[model samples]
Target: MSRAVLWTKVVAGGLLMVVGGPAFVEYIRPSDEELRKRYNPDLQKRSAEQGERRAQEFDDYVNKLKHWSKSDKSIWYAAQEELDNKRAAIEAQRAQAKEETRTQREEMRKEMLGEK
Candidate 1:
């Protein structure tokens, strides 16, 4: 290419980068809260729903176990144990969420009071 054309191309490329870099970063970059919200907008609601469904399943299994023959007792107990583990995990998740919300509220309160 001619010198003038090459210089013009370089200038245009620089201009595009200068203008587009921030826009590109802004378009792709997400704040921590935004990322969390995008990934789990209704954490409490979803967790509660999942816990409810699992509890219902546990109840159904218990009822089935109650009427099942003695030979099947071990199988039913194993299933119940699995459900118990799931319930424990769900409870832990709920506790973690509660802790996070509590910390967030405390931070907001401190911000309002002009304290770090």
Candidate 2:
């Protein structure tokens, strides 16, 4: 092939690499906002909340480990106590939510039945 034709091909290939490469990457890997838009808002919020909860749990575990390392408490006992505390917290949260729901139902019933 002629040198002119060879150079033309090289320049075209380089330009394609420079421009098309980015376009391809952009299409293949979407931006964070684009990814967020694709999922349901509820799912995104739940995922974020779940991640935060997991991170907090991890931090708590690490802190407990540090404390256990310094103190005379056995790891098994400490771990069981932590689990019990977590269960109690979960039960408290459920109780609070259940009470709130009952309160709302009572209020709605009063409004609908026209009773005090």
Candidate 3:
């Protein structure tokens, strides 16, 4: 080639390298997608373990509340009141059933004796 053309080409090539070097390095750098794929399973396992721990903590708190209901007087009283109400309802039903049975028995006795 001509000397002028050779020098011009060399200077142009050097200028291109200088301008694009940093961008070229960045383009060849490993991507976040590759790094993320490596750690994704470990991240999911940690997240799931944290969720299970949170669930266990919630269950423990609920169990504590249940124990407190049994031990603490106010909570015990509330629970006892509920139990008392249930017992009262059951007793009331039993009394009604007994009254009904007695009535039916009396009616049968009267029919057998021809009293009414």
Per-candidate TM-scores read 0.37, 0.44, 0.37
Q: Clashes in model 1: which pairs? A: none
Looking at model 1, residue 15 earns an lDDT score of: 89
Local accuracy of candidate 2 as per-residue lDDT tens digits, 55-101: 99999889988876776778878778878999999999999999999
Taking the tens digit of each residue's C-alpha lDDT, what string does model 1 give over 1-116? 79999999999999899999989998899886665566554885686579789999999877766655344458667667768999999999999999999999999999989963
State the lDDT at 112 in candidate 1. 88
Candidate 3 lDDT by residue in tens digits, 1-116: 79999999999999889978977998888797665567779896786679789999999878856866787478767667767999999999999999999999999999989964
User: Candidate 3: misplaced stretches above 4 Å?
Assistant: 1-73
Off by over 4 Å in 1: 1-73
**lDDT over C-alpha atoms for residue 19 of model 1:** 93
Q: How many times do residue backbones clash in model 1?
A: 0
Q: Which model scores highest in TM-score?
A: 2
Off by over 4 Å in 2: 1-62
lDDT, candidate 1, equals 0.82
How many pairs of residues collide in each model? 0, 0, 0
How far is 97's C-alpha from truth in model 3 (Å)?
0.3
The candidate that achieves the highest lDDT relative to the unseen native structure: 2
